[model samples]
Target: MPILMLIEYFRATMQQWSFQKRNVAAEAKRTLTPWAETIIQANKNACNNWMVYPISNSRFVVKSFTHKSVVVDFQQRTCTCSRWQIDGLPCGHVIKVLTMSRYKDCSEFDFKAYFIETLRKNYEESVNPLPSPLESKIPGDLMIVKPPMMEMRQPGRPRNIDRILSQGERPIWQECSTCGKFRQTRSDCTSRGSRSGISQATVHIQR
Candidate 1:
């Protein structure tokens, strides 16, 4: 019953957007986070600033204005910084090497996993509407089961009475019981005297 309601809700929502352009890739590209776009743009700009020196057919060394260098291998799709290998996106150094190699579509160095087409295909499947419960034939012997009992939680901060911490799981710092300052116990606390004493000292200093 809940699944049927969810399907119906999804169908109704999809109907509202059915008239809009249905390009999944375009939609996915539009939804890229600002930080992601910034990184891509920064990489592009960095590619322009870096100088590419060819080492072999597929290998090169990219050097920045500051003499900071990184080795780039187009064949392995890797950079010395490891960013390209880990993220599957070409780093600025790799981009500069690709540009020097005369590759027109340096952006293609980015993994297809980040492509809009891949994203679109993931969400392309449509949920079908389920038949009305009244029209469906259920067995006469099968009884309608009641929902499981759920205790209403009391409105307050829950206690961790059931929590069992291991011997290894100790707090990062010991705190004083008297002053509540961390990294020391109550015995080590210097401010154990009355607050009035500290207040009087402050007033005296001010005067």
Candidate 2:
């Protein structure tokens, strides 16, 4: 079967497994006892490093120990540091604002795009297993693709793909063959008085 067709065939299977992994993780993060302890520690650390001044139920200003100020808005789900909008997780400043809010109706999401119920509902559609590749058959009208032609084998030991060159190093000829010096090739070698190598290859080398 074609590579693309293979991917499409297992697309549902892939999504099903991926959802399972994320679901497990989200549940773990939400319920982890150690994480709660960590949060309590983080809150204490936050107090030492930052000062939050409430502007409204949903807005606040957080000032760091270094005097760097960032705005936090719970209503818009945004922070000046951009973690809330970009990472889809509340930033430290926004978390502080939430802790101070007194309104019972000033609600916030469990998380920005990854609530437990949302993940379950999104992957709720019934997914059936695809037939084994050996058991599957291609349509007769579908054009059968031939194997790709083998590349011509290069002579000499293959260059190690993992080899990293140092600064100013490359695979190409770095020294002039005639004079065995750097920064100049045989085509423009001015120190040819010392040696007469690369005479044959000079014709092939560009001027």
Candidate 3:
């Protein structure tokens, strides 16, 4: 299903590219990807939810409605929330701080990864359609491989007793009736007790 989706995406991308006269980078810039535009819009909306307090020309503290505050350092390009550092895109706190500092464009601070040129380069490669199985050629020198043998199950309802025993309906170890111990039978436990008694008798004789 994932492979089919990828094939469909490649087909659609190639179909769209066929209509474009200009290069992929130019075409990509003309129309921004949905995800890039979405992030931009989200950051813009989030600016209203934040309150910016200027610490210096490059440092700021942005407080949200929930009383959550994060420090934004423009010079370092980092936010205490760590989103800006990880994603390479200015998060809500950074955006709010930048806006408070009278920075007109927030996109200048966005990472190169989100740039249209980067996106264009990623999709620039052509994916050719595969040849039909009928047209596919196999080397004559290669050995022919046969399908694996199928093992047929016995034609009866499987015994539930074995399944139950395997699943712990019956205990694997037998308890010794003589010593109340597991794994050994009553006769084996009696023999062990006799050996211990003999050892104790020998020690007493030596003493």
Candidate 4:
């Protein structure tokens, strides 16, 4: 029942998300919102304090007044500062270069992942509702599982322990009295017909 509830909850969430995406996509005229444009413009205006050196028609080097420099590549849509490739948005360095190259719209330099068409296509598919699994006809070849098996082990601390030791601590090795071997307890000793230790223990108990 919990599994069914989980599947139903996810289905409902997907439906809701699809609806929201469709609405936002329909209202979107451009990739960047007005707020994003405002931020980009603010950065573009601040670029006046930076120096731009054009390396080629597609690449340029930008340096801030603070002596920090970064490379901007238009063909690759990447900046050395990495904001252009990471966030799919142009960094201030790229904006500075675009202005020098006489590009009027800075938003056009954004990656296709941030495009309005991509946003519209992402939510085009509708999420369908699921029927009850118990009511549905299941295939005969489907593998079924059972939980009738019993746990045969005791519920308590075990004697044979295998774990890491603490710092500067030596390992504790066990020696069996019957087998006279390391790491084997007397109960699991494999020395055949070794009853001398048991006879002496019985005699001590009787005395």
Best by TM-score: 4
- Model 2, 1-207: lDDT tens digits are 498587875787787787775566556544323333364446445645577787876778998876479998768878898866665545567666665553222214335344544554555664556667778897889988899999999999865634556676655535777778765667767665544654322212222
- What count of clashes does model 3 give? 0
TM-score of each: 0.50, 0.50, 0.60, 0.66
> Model 1 over residues 84-184: C-alpha lDDT tens digits?
88877777887677677677665577776665565655556554456788999988899888999999999999655335556666434655687777655
Tens-digit lDDT track for model 3 on 1-207? Answer: 588678777877876674352254555553345476687678779779678788888898888887578898988888999988887777888877777778776777878777776776676665566655468796889988899999999999754422323342444466667777665566556556654432211011110
**What local lDDT score does residue 194 receive in model 3, on the 0 to 100 scale?**
51
lDDT of 1: 0.66
- Angstrom error of the Cα, residue 131, model 2: value is 1.9
The parts of candidate 3 lying over 4 Å away from their true place are 1-32, 132-135, 155-157, 160-207
lDDT of 4: 0.75
Model 3: ten consecutive residues of lowest lDDT: 198-207
lDDT of 2 at 106: 21
The digit string of per-residue lDDT tens for model 4 on 86-150 reads 77777889888877778888768776666667777888998989987877997899888888889
Instruction: Output the better candidate (1/4) by lDDT.
Output: 4
Candidate 2 regions with alpha-carbon error over 4 angstroms: 1-49, 56-58, 103-112, 133-135, 148-154, 157-207
